[model samples]
Target: MKTTFQHVNYYWDKKKEKDLKNDQIELFLYRSNILGKDLRITNYGGGNTSCKTIEKDPLTNEEVEVMWVKGSGGDIGTLTRQGIAGLYTKRLRDLKKVYKGLHDEDRMVSLFNHCIYDLNSKAPSIDTPLHGLLPFKHIDHLHPDALIAIAAAKDGEKIVKEIWGDTMGWVPWQRPGFDLALQLEKCLNDNPGIRGIVLGSHGLFTWGDTSYECYINSLEVIETASEYIHQKIKKNNTVFGGEKIQSLSKKERLEKAALLAPVLRGLCSSENQMIGHFTDNDAVMEFINSNDLLRLAPMGTSCPDHFLRTKIQPLVLDLETNEDISNTGDIVKKLTPSFEKYRQEYKEYYEQCKHKNSPAMRDPNPVIIIYPGIGMFSFAKNKQTARVASEFYINAINVMKGAEAISEYTSLPRQEAFDIEYWLLEEAKLQRMPKEKPLSRKIALVTGAGGGIGKAIADKLVKEGANVIFADIVENRLREATKSYNKDIGSYILCDVTKEEDIKNALNKTCLDYGGIDIVIHSAGLAISNPIEQTSREDWDTLQNVLVKGQFELIKQAVSVMRKQQLGGNIVSIASKNGLVSGPNNVGYGTAKAAQQHMVRLLAAELAKDKIRVNTVNPDGVIIGSKIWEGDWAEGRAKTYGIDVKDLPAHYAKRNLLNEIIYPEDIANGVFALVAILHKSTGNSINVDGGMASAFVR
Candidate 1:
């Protein structure tokens, strides 16, 4: 009989499996990748899969059994050969004789290194023994939301019996380690012919003689559990005690989210600056708008992985339906007390649960925050971490949904949650992480980032680890410019700097996309060179609008977000040497450049109290790799200098004192020095014109 599934997908393909039939490890990777493709099956970096293979022993010249399992901190969806750890099954089983008791389980983790079958293998995860000790050749351990929902239900054991009778076994809550592995062994041995076991308040485990059987067994168990929960949900009249408030329109929710994100990001980043992520998908909106939110939110999450990323509980913003969310001051006034209360409570939780050997208290700020009628906001050290945290919380919501649909939902005990959160093993893994880049937590917005100098500045910032938003007036240019970058690090938006609405929209998008802005680069401009007799009113206005007024509007809108974040910021304008030098046929462009230069000085002095630094980088004759020079500006300048357009680069280069040519990259370096290196100095112009004496600031 064929079993169809409504909740989980069966992605196995015989043709694909045949290609890797000869290689055991390759088949293991294929199975793991397919299972991890769906978040409902396993969230990012949450689950583990293992296979025992016979490999030649390099030292003995004989075959030995080696258990290959997902290494510590590796995500199964993106797992590679390097991401798997190999250990001798014999050595792992030998440790069972040395095990003193459950209290001494941590010592076994350190001993796992001694069993390494491959010297180059990654460090083994804590769950290594869980797979090694099991008799099956292939095993799968996953924290699927549907299965965890069954595991976390109050009557989880009874429900397990109803679903599979004696065909599956049940084990009570035990933190993953040597003890849990032992319990699983006992359960499987005690219940013969059982295909899997449901770990109470944790997850599910399944095993088989082959990789395909193991994969199919895991799917069957999860699919059955998901169908059971789906039927119960259909029978219920409402979920989460019915929604307490209607959801806001998509436009309203995003507008409110944009305004609230920076303030929340600033408050959460008091100890260390954070990048932000916002999600208003159906899952988040349903949970936040539910009547059960106040009751269930503080109960916290059950799965250790969920609790690790999303903390013990989220901070719930008790926003009333009548409250004015658009008023920034009102939002701040109401949220301040709630933030303070959350911090104080978090500190108390640490005091109550901490052991003498526990690590020092971490930042007390909440990682996840829920705003009713709006959406959820998550913050972390970088954009990806923040986004993943949001995804994990949504998984937690799903687990709760399934549990509450059948029986009362249950969370992990407070002390157990604390033990997992501050475990020494987790701390050691964190210490091994590489140091962050100089601009790791910073966010940047680069106008005119479609190409040339602007694109170069955006690339430099992203290289230094900042999440950048590329803003330009042209759509195709924006798409083409951002194509080469990692989608996570760089994003693009069409923006005309001359319009105030465009500037405002771009800044709002920046806050929504990456939390808030820390660095702003105004490089968008158009040049119009003309003699006094030929200069038109239209030509003068266009230059001023793009070069001067555009810079003014971008800075004006961006500063509000910076101030709200209270993290301080940097503003760099790519002005020109013509701003300082008196050049021919440059009446309109020169005046606009000069205005841009002085505006930096004025803003630097005005925004000093807010710790916002404003500066300028001036470059001249950047003829190669510049869009500005590709147009009329080059021809007009060449005409005035009595040279052909092709000779403009050489003519301009020879005139400089060093006879060096300036490129867009040189201008980018000047901006980098101002923002990344010269932190203490501002209101100064750095000339990158190859030692042009006339452009030097006196």
Candidate 2:
């Protein structure tokens, strides 16, 4: 309830605007944007709005009364005129008689769609009947976190009556259907001049003669609710202190997170589907480290709407209390039983509430897992959904916290939760999701991803559906790279490969965000040319840090994660042609790479037993976009070979037998082959130099 109104940048398609405004749909869309962007009013997809209007009948030119209601599966903030379905007002209200004692969701939808006032309009919201039954020209319904804090309270009814006086109506919990609509209509009729209606364990509904009135009504109500909760928390002494202390400190949590993520990911991997976990943010850390987490987290989500994404309740683990927390075996042993207990408890709950022919119960596995001293993991069928679910719960945490502070948090009863979770209306919305991409749930961490070759490789992997972490020293570029990707598909960290602390923190971040790294593409290295006789000691050490020592450290950390999960993984090094066959002035580049190449082979020999494949993609003339070959360095290289800088690329390309000029994408393709398809291939060098016969080892 710290409220501020931010105007949305909007424009008019003059002709369309004039037409829509006359129908009241234009005002509906503009106000919807106002609500959608405000987090306190609605979180993501948890609200709806509508307007009563008139449209002309095409054939008769007769004015027809209609209700332009927000459609199913659309966010209130982003709703447009198309997103607002125009349903025949009287027709929709009259249809409630047919559905009166029925819980037939599919039948209800079919009838609703059939009564569209405009055939071209989008599907109306599932709660259209609720809005239609109301007498006002405009209606605003929202699951605002603050309002939910009041509605989901133990004595919610009493609190509402006290705060708003008898000017508000109270409707007890009823599944959203024709009955709920009828019950709401009855309540509003009984309380003649009510400002709003409060649905127990649900949300707020306000209506008015105009859009502006309804929007302001919602804001005032939310402010009152938020003020009540704020005072309650202050009185109870339950407000969150800034950054609470943890049993296992941040460093220790990162350490455990590195070990635990892969194991969880491995256990959750099977079939064509896989799951990744998101646990890196400050909100998750605060919740996990809090003292009352165990008691409060098990209480459930703020609303039943979250049941599908978060499960009935998260599985909680006390990692700090376990003996040998460092031993992943001990951690795994504890988690196995915890997961089973959660699964069994869910099954019992499902059986207790399921109707005789309810749809197949969702997988009993918990979607959210709370492990204090580490963090909470929100797992899902794909990376994007997993990420969205993670954010959804993070937002819910505040609402739950508010409810807990005001009164013992109250979620919908178990039977009501089951109805929403299994409703055919919701199930159809879920089924509409398109098929997963080939590499959909695979997690990859790519170093040097801010620019050049590393950027290209990262892009290719994303195209194949991998969730990628782009780690680079270029902070600005790295930030932009993460922004380009869907938040679920890509993220970044500023990293200096030569620094152990940088590498460690980056690894921990990847572990926390993605469960573990399936593919570690080591692309962080430099190319320098200096004669063996003239190479300075400083230059030698600098290049060596990047190529040899830095790569070794990365492998060391990655293997530790792979070993814990006991799942086979891939490590790829981007070595150069100079390593295989040193050119005249590439002593620094050649020496560092030779050591790095041999180190990859040695790692392959040792890690093969761990099912960790190690390989190299060596490209001789991938000069199209490689930053290593830019500027005076290329001129210097051309001078060494007694050729013009302009002709340098052709010289290297023809030196290869294939006569084709290789590109960064070609090199990426080779790396993709090794990591994605070459399961039995390890300790191998795949040359992407169009076929460099001289550099070819075979």
The estimated TM-scores of all candidates read 0.97, 0.87
TM-score computed on alpha carbons, candidate 2: 0.87
Task: Indicate the residue-level lDDT of 354 in model 1.
Answer: 97
Pairs clashing in candidate 1? Answer: none
User: Which digits, one per residue and each the tens of the lDDT, describe model 1 over residues 1-698?
Assistant: 23356777778778888888658898888889988998998989998999999999999999999999999999988888999999999999898888888789779899999999988788999999989988888899999999899999999999999999999999999988887888988998899889998999999889888888888899888988998999999999799999899887999888878887898998898788999999999998889999999999999999999989988999988776446756656777778899999999999999999999999998899999998888899999999888889999999999999999999999999999999999989888888998999889999999999999999899899988899999999889899989987656999989999999999899989999999999999999888888988999999999999999999999998998998888999999999999998988899999999999999999999999999999999989898988999898888988998899999989989999999989889998898889889999789999998898887787
Q: Which candidate has the highest TM-score of all? A: 1
For residue 312, model 2's alpha carbon misses the true position, in angstroms, by 0.6
- How well is each residue in 174-283 modelled by candidate 2, as lDDT tens digits? 77777788888999889999999988777889987877677777777777777877788778774443334454666666676666777776555532335566564676
When summed lDDT is taken over every stretch of 10 residues in candidate 1, the lowest stretch is: 320-329
On the 0 to 100 scale, the lDDT of residue 123 in model 1 is 92
Q: Pick the candidate with the highest lDDT.
A: 1
**Prediction-by-prediction clash tally:** 0, 1
| lDDT value for model 1 | 0.91
